[model samples]
Target: MTTDELKGLKVASLVDARGTACPGPLLAAKKAMGDIESGEILEVYSSDEGTKVDIPKWCQKMGHDYLGVVEESSYVRMFLKKS
Candidate 1:
């Protein structure tokens, strides 16, 4: 979805997982989900390359929806829709 469309959706937390390693982004994303409503989205920003793989796998294993990933100059943005 477009950034504007995503902006319309509720974001529980913008987890800045940048500079963190494996499991760190996932951990933060999971923690962020806890603070939001069930259907809300948790947006995660991470510099760790592992996030590209780990986040999706974690989402699958946890039964959450891995929306998509956006790449930026120095980091990547992962969008997760809580189920």
Candidate 2:
């Protein structure tokens, strides 16, 4: 989804994993997912470049909906809807 579209979404939880690396951000997302209900949105912020690819792949493998990513100067925000 577009950044504007994602911005309009009601995120259920926000995981600010910025400053973390690789699996750190991914792990944070996994833990945060459990706090939200099914069909709810999770927004993950990460500075780790790996998260750009890792999160979407994780969502795909876990059967969650990988909405998209919004790039920022210091970090990128990824959106996912839990299945």
Candidate 3:
């Protein structure tokens, strides 16, 4: 989806991994998925450059819906749907 479309999403959970590196964001996203209901949207805020690729791959492997991302000044915001 477009950045504007993602911005308007109703996120069910948010994982902020801006302070951590590569796997941190992905791990947080994994954990956060347990907290939200199936089909709910999980938003991840990561400063790690690798998370952009890692998350989408993770989502694909995990059978979740990878909603795409939005890159801001310092962080990239990603969205995924729990499966």
The TM-score values for the models, in the order shown, are 0.85, 0.97, 0.97
In the range 1-83, model 3's lDDT, one tens digit per residue, is 88899999999998888989868998999999999999899999999999998998999999999999999999999999999
Considering lDDT, where higher is better, how would the candidates rank from best to worst?
Answer: 3, 2, 1
Q: lDDT winner among the candidates?
A: 3
Could you tell me how far off, in angstroms, the CA of residue 51 lies in candidate 2 after the best superposition?
A: 0.5
Question: What are the root-mean-square deviations of the candidates from the true structure over C-alphas?
Answer: 1.9, 0.6, 0.6
The backbone clash count of each candidate, in order, is: 0, 0, 0
TM-score of 3: 0.97
| Candidate 1 lDDT over residue span 12-48, tens digit each | 7789989888879888888888888777788999999
User: What is candidate 2's lDDT per residue for 1-83, written digit by digit as tens?
Assistant: 77899888999999999988878999999999999999999999999998898888889999999999999999999999999
Task: Show where candidate 2 strays beyond 4 Å.
Answer: none
Displacement of residue 65 (Cα, Å) in model 2 is 0.2
Indicate whether candidate 1 or candidate 2 has the larger lDDT. Answer: 2
The true-versus-predicted C-alpha distance at residue 20 of model 3, in Å, is: 0.2
